[model samples]
Target: MKPRFTALLTLLVVALLGGCASQPPLRQAKDVDLARYMGTWYVIGHVPYFAEKGDVATADEYRLKPDGDIAVTYHYRKGFDAPEKTWAGKAWLPDPADTAHWKVQLVWPLRSDYVIVDLAPDYRSVLIGLPSRKLMWIMARERQLPAAEYQRLLAVAKAEGFPVDQVRKVPQRCEDLGQAGFEQP
Candidate 1:
């Protein structure tokens, strides 16, 4: 009985700690332009989860597949010595309110939320969020942008309550870009 109580107490503590962890919040699309929003985006920021706590310079691209469903590819740079890690998934627009925003039903659909938040005026960059807003990814056409424009977007993200530091600079791989389709106009 003593051992069992100790184990139960430990489990409770872990659960409580987990609950207290910070996460990105669910955000509404201030505005969306479907045509401009379509295309690949490099992930810049996300709330940390236990599995990939030390990842950096990660990015993701979203494309509308030939069949109309959405294709998602996640890329992460694990430590300086390790090669980038990549994963792919499929998603679709589910909201009757807006077709531009979507819900991805990947193998581990419940594990992540893929919400398209903001899009560039010219459709160059986009902001996405996991369902819980615990994770977010900002993608752009260029690996780097003008400092002023970048700062403006960062401010927008901050107003939305995301950890701005999580938005890191992702190194572009031309080979990967070839795999992602052009942004729909």
Candidate 2:
């Protein structure tokens, strides 16, 4: 009994210390203009969740609802030649004052964090992140970001404590453009 208690206490101490050493609270971009943010944003870079494996030419379309919830349609192709597919979800602000932090529900019951970590002044580009920076999406108005802008976003993500090395460049082809759901008039 004495040995077991000693071992358990040692583990507890290590856990507490580890928590203290963990990364600081993630910083988010302030004052997001929701209307300006609504549109089709092409995914140029991402730290994909398992479901996104082999995804190509990915994009997300957001439509602001009267009740302030965002209707999201995620479009992607499994491969370069595969047909485009879509998934739907909704995102809502947990605190009305904090527009940058959203609780996105992609499936029933479970909600995930969606933080606007960075956004271009022109609204042409943006970066959204999940908790622990384990997932992130670098999106822009076009299929790909310019080299300079991409590098700038990479630096911003790194400064924000994301694992930059884990980011995968999402493939986008000009031929994939103008798909019905991915393109908005």
TM-score per prediction, in order, is 0.60, 0.80
What are the lDDT figures for the candidates, one per model? 0.54, 0.76
**Per-residue lDDT of model 1, residues 1-185, tens digit only:** 34334334433433343345365544556566555556656554344444334554466667777776778765665554568776666777676466545655434413233556666678777676544434555667766555566666667677776677665444344333323221111
lDDT per residue, candidate 2, 1-185, as tens digits?
34334334433433333234357767888899889989899998876544666678889999999999999888987677778888787989999899898877655545667789899999999988765666678899998789799889989999987888878777787564454323221
Going through the candidates in the order shown, the clash numbers are: 8, 0
Clashing pairs in 1: 24-133, 24-134, 42-139, 43-59, 43-60, 44-167, 113-130, 113-131
User: What residue runs in model 1 are displaced by over 4 Å at the alpha carbon?
Assistant: 1-36, 51-57, 79-84, 109-111, 165-185
In model 2, pairs of residues that clash are none
